[model samples]
Target: MRQKATSLFAVLLLLAAGVAPVGAVVGTGVEASAVQSNCSFPVTATDATGTEVTVEQKPENVVTLGPSEAQTMWEIGGKSQVVGLTKYASYLDGSDSRTNVSGAGRSYVNVEKVVAEDPGIVLAANIVSNETVQKLRDAGLTVYKFEKAKSLEDIYAKTTLVGELTGNCEGASETLSWMKDRISTVRSAVEGSDAPRVFVSQGAGWTAGENTFINRMVELAGGNNVAVEANVSGYGKISEEVIVAQNPEWIVQLGAFGAYPKTDAYNGTDAVKNGRVMTVSNQNVSQPAPRVVYAIVKMAEAFHPDAFAAANATTTASETTTTQPTESTTESAPETTTEGAMEGDSTETTTDAEDSTGGTPGFGVPVALAALAGAAMLARRR
Candidate 1:
């Protein structure tokens, strides 16, 4: 239960700026301070909405209202403290013990069940309305609402905030360090490599555009996002004609299912004829948590196999040959920047909103990443 408020700012600042492994050091000033402040109570923290919340004691029972928050809590070593979560919490392998207590989409919250749990702290995202937050506050409950994170910096800030609240600032620092290292690793691997024109599909015609984590992920992995190139911002749908017009070299579908059923739709495109279409797990890509690193690496390998040849290369020449790039190497694709998208003005059409309560059953991650994801699913069953 160590909560060092002193090093909190410094650690968070490093993470928000993005991780560079060149001269990074962990657990010196900030981490040591966190370790020294174990079990500290009456701590004050500010939420993403500029609200200051003071916790008189360590929260033994916690409730997370969103998948991203739940995943963040687990990363900061507070998973065992979570007592309740939404039905979508099932995405994490060991979430069976946590009961589903969310509303239908992202608006309503089951206030009755939330109060019954007697949680010391209740976590929520921006999608949760102000009225609902007031209801919980009126009941004398502690609630912290996180604004919708549009960038990696926002995610790091939110993660650090949770660490401060849960008295796991040390864990938070460690997790952020891990994330920075992973991101740095991927970036270095793909440096100076060609950025292939890639279409990121989340099934049902929805795709991630600017102001979204997925968009940033593509840029970090050295893949040109065709949706962003088409001026599509935020999660929106583009017509089939637009897809044909763009003619992406690679199609990286985010969910369990592919947006395009057969190659007929992409008959002449590079993704179909060249077999460069890939399916990634929704849980890894959708949740803005530590698992995002997995998504970055997955897309990097797909977009630039040659960039990762050294690490992926095996002693056997035959297996090495298999890892070679099959698709045409994109030489001069557009370089992506972290441009924020307009909120609520997106024209993209999505089958379902994946705010906090949505779930795609058939989505699956690679076996290696899946094992790491499961191990991160720390639980504290009431």
Candidate 2:
């Protein structure tokens, strides 16, 4: 039965891939699709992993449910649309784009907050409850349901979708093409060579489960992950006995706020003694931010230290010290987003930075509606 179940799971994964190839939408809404062909055939794209995204026209106010999606949207130049974010996104650098309208986890998001944001479309994670989806629809908000994007392909497709929704499809296509070329280059570099034996430990917990995005990163970065020994779940913290037995040559600590110090953290382990361990920023390595390709390169450096010896321009100590954004992030978290209204922290308001492209910032038609509302109230008083 176990063998049969595993077979079924594999079959489903393949089936999912076939129907939802990396580039274009099949049998779904055409304009609603997150990914589109890049002006020609034989296009390479980030294969989406069962994310049902329906973006209408150009969404002005966008809300993201998961940390990965939140980070991705911001990286593809969609930060202005983000009116909602989970608490975890706050941990990564610039991950906390929106204020704390929602809770840290699932509890942070409420219908009232979503309504206050008045978002034209809400980009939510796949695991949300049926009731929540219905509630958003009932409130007249378009919900774009996306599964957790797990692979590099997932990242590309999601970024492309963001571009399409933001009227920046051209930018997205160019970016993805550039990324694909980089992936090819990196793959070629690692081909036919013995990569490092790597063990990636989630900073807060043990190892990752099966089929995680992290596992895919392992495959891409050309390292063998130790956590594959877990059961059908795909991720589980291995026992210390198991870890000691394998004695992986490399240990990677994944954390949101840059890399956490593992000197004392992983003592009594071979990874610590041999100094084969590295702490990488989860925001860089995991989140859907624009720097993901850079993250892959960083991981590649960790796996095959020789190939990427020149990659370490900035040491971890300097990065951690200078880029520590605790105060700004925390200060911005409660009052800077539409979520601030939901969190009861919406008081003063400020303008966003002008488009670096030097054009007028697009604030959507809802801002026009707000102006009309204020004008109507004043006219009635007069």
Candidate 3:
């Protein structure tokens, strides 16, 4: 079908958008520590390129080759040290002040611009090509290329490595602590709840599959990814026939442009029939940064609202008893409610809840009916 062809094209673009060159050196046998140790200057570590990278001292200025790298710097309180970044990172606060090292497109990097910044260190995302990195090195720059983040654990490791490289050890530790606590809270909230069949639509019928961060988020949020069930690997398109057969209870779209295709297969699904479709910010879900917890929490709250609300109440009560109450101590839990199910009406019951860091909440849907629908589908399939 024309829609299927478009979906395939979208996925191919996503793969190529990373800009990873053919025959790039892939990190082999790379392992990240569960807990970060002490922070010391002149630290030595092997990067994703299997090259020994040493930071002789704390970097005074750094350059980021990708938006995710820039976002990580902002999260760890090292934004001040970033003197340059790609234009894609413009969404970050005060990013306009940083030098733009972007080339003609989102995936291209301007080596001349990066060299012009004269940064003390350069942090490269996995998407950066080996030739680009080698060119920068030949120009007499110290560049550390990170491996692709496959899981939350991998993200944690990258955070640690970034902090160690930039000498922002304290900030990294604090960030990690916050991330772990939030994840633990979410996991506890959905501990015994039924997991609905969730289909993640990245627009144009593109779906996230196994070994991808989006898939991990769905699992963490207590939903089974339908793309994984269909045996779609990495970023790929799921056939319309397969979507109708699986009959997902919830459909989560990434980014503002994400939408369910207008077709019988999508229209007939329970997600469309029951108003269980929701959209979340692509920045929070797509980027491998600390903010990813926002996507996970949003999904969990939608997938299991009652359980999430109960857990939040207990957490608030516990915090109140342990510490003196302050004006900022109040937790804002987003109310979840069902609306009239309408086809293509994804924002009907969306709500926003501010996170602990005062970050704006992403879109969410309160989907209490998912459990019932999921159970019925399972019974029929059996």
Give the top-scoring candidate (lDDT).
3
Cα displacement (angstroms), candidate 3, residue 289, comes to 1.7
As for candidate 1, its clashing pairs are: 1-39, 2-38, 80-380, 236-348, 237-348, 237-349
Against the true structure, candidate 1 reaches a TM-score of 0.69
Clashes, model 2: 9
- Candidate ranking (TM-score, best to worst): 3, 1, 2
Query: Superposing every Cα of model 2 onto the true structure, what RMSD results?
Result: 16.7
> Candidate 3 residues 1-382, lDDT tens each?
5544333322222322321111212342223444344567797777766788888999899999766678778887898999998655666778889998766422347899999999888997665666677889999999987665556776666676788888887677767766766677789888988899999976557677786657878999999999999998766668899999999999997653356677999989999999999877655665566667777888998999999888877665333121111111111111111010110111111120111111111111211122223223334554
lDDT of each: 0.56, 0.47, 0.64
Off by over 4 Å in 1: 1-39, 104-107, 261-263, 309-382
Name the regions of candidate 3 deviating beyond 4 angstroms: 1-15, 18-38, 105-107, 316-382
Error of 2 at 113 (Å): 1.6
TM-score result, candidate 3: 0.74
| Backbone clashes counted, model 3 | 0
Pull out the clashing pairs in model 3.
Answer: none
